[model samples]
Target: MKATHNPPTDVQVTPADLLRMAALYLRRHGWTQGTYYASDAPADNPTPPACVVGAIGIACAGHKVEHFADLDTDDRHTYLDAIAVLVDYLDDHYPIHLFDDDGLCIDDHTSPYSWNDDPLCTADKVIAALEGAAKEWDRLHTQGGEQ
Candidate 1:
């Protein structure tokens, strides 16, 4: 019986790298909300518009966001950690929607995807969050954290 050879996964994709990749992907292609790319989004060339998290998943998975879930668990964990960093940043600095315009707090600990999907969450903000996460990891690495 012949043994099947599994193809190697994208093991080298790190959180910091993933953040930067997602940021750049958003910058080049475009940003969207509510879905992993627009419903009418094209397959390639245009590279379909995606939200912040969508971009991260797409970037890690490469080319298509559908492939993101197919990645090994380790890879998913590493990349998801990066996404968490962005969520943390949003929960800290953004969350404009969480406010009811009366300066009252609401929906505590809401999912970051809600923030990402917020109309107030612009592409620039998402890009900044991604960059911030990358810088944050970089700082940690410099401060005796994991590499």
Candidate 2:
């Protein structure tokens, strides 16, 4: 039998990058379109509820909505650490499905909206979602996927 090679298991990604990816995913899937806030505005004003849900959904799947408060921390240094914990949680749980266009369920692995080859919504899932969104944006604007 020929030897089989396995890819590395550990994924290294920053929480901010993950958030950016989530934002891109949300925009691509019609969650943040036409929703704008001033650059200096507070988080609550600019960050949509769906984005929060998506972040929580990805970080803590199947968790009750009320539990979000428990996850909040006062430690300034641990802010990104909190996000890292959530990203780690996504390694095992199905990511929160944010796309709801045409009543299509994109989160379901069996649904036509399911784009990734794998079922779990890990880092690859986020990346895939971002890539799909970029493609859709490109198709719409004819920007040739620049920037």
Candidate 3:
């Protein structure tokens, strides 16, 4: 009987790097583009709606710093799959903690805790969402087949 060869295991895709890959994916897919500004929002406005900026920030902060640019094709796919999971979670859960910038706290009308208070929460949530997503991606890839 012939034995199947296992794929090489020299490459490793880190969560931080995966996040960066996800950010790039968003950019490639027109999911994120352009500079974002909040000045036009009403001074009393509670929260800025979710936007590409948050997604981009999530990708930028969550990706692996050391191995971001260097991944084999298989590794890249694994990374992207993980990123996709994170993106999906961000789209669904949209956790407020993602964008919580304690330093940005202003007053009662716009406390970070409020759901409608800040975009920073989006960024913060990406990190948390990616953690879960990465594990799922890794499992899917290791087990076989696309996730």
Best by TM-score: 1
Across 71-142, the per-residue lDDT of candidate 1 in tens digits comes to: 678768876788777766666777444667788877665465787887777889889888987887777766
| Candidate 2 structure quality by residue, lDDT tens digits, 111-136 | 21231223443334544444443344
Worst 10 residues of 3 by lDDT: 108-117
Better of 2 and 3 by TM-score: 3
Candidate 3 regions exceeding 4 Å error are 1-9, 12-17, 20-82, 95-122, 139-147
Order of candidate numbers by TM-score, starting with the best? 1, 3, 2
What is the TM-score of candidate 1?
Answer: 0.73
Q: Which model is ahead, 1 or 2, in terms of lDDT?
A: 1
Measured with C-alpha atoms, the lDDT of residue 37 in candidate 1 is 80
Candidate No. with top lDDT: 1
The Cα error of candidate 2 at residue 46, in Å, is 21
Q: Any idea what lDDT model 2 has? A: 0.39
- Regions of candidate 1 where Cα sits further than 4 Å from its true position: 1-11, 43-46, 66-69, 96-110, 145-147
Q: What does the lDDT read for residue 134 in candidate 2?
A: 33
Winner on TM-score between 1 and 3 is 1
Clashes of each: 0, 0, 13
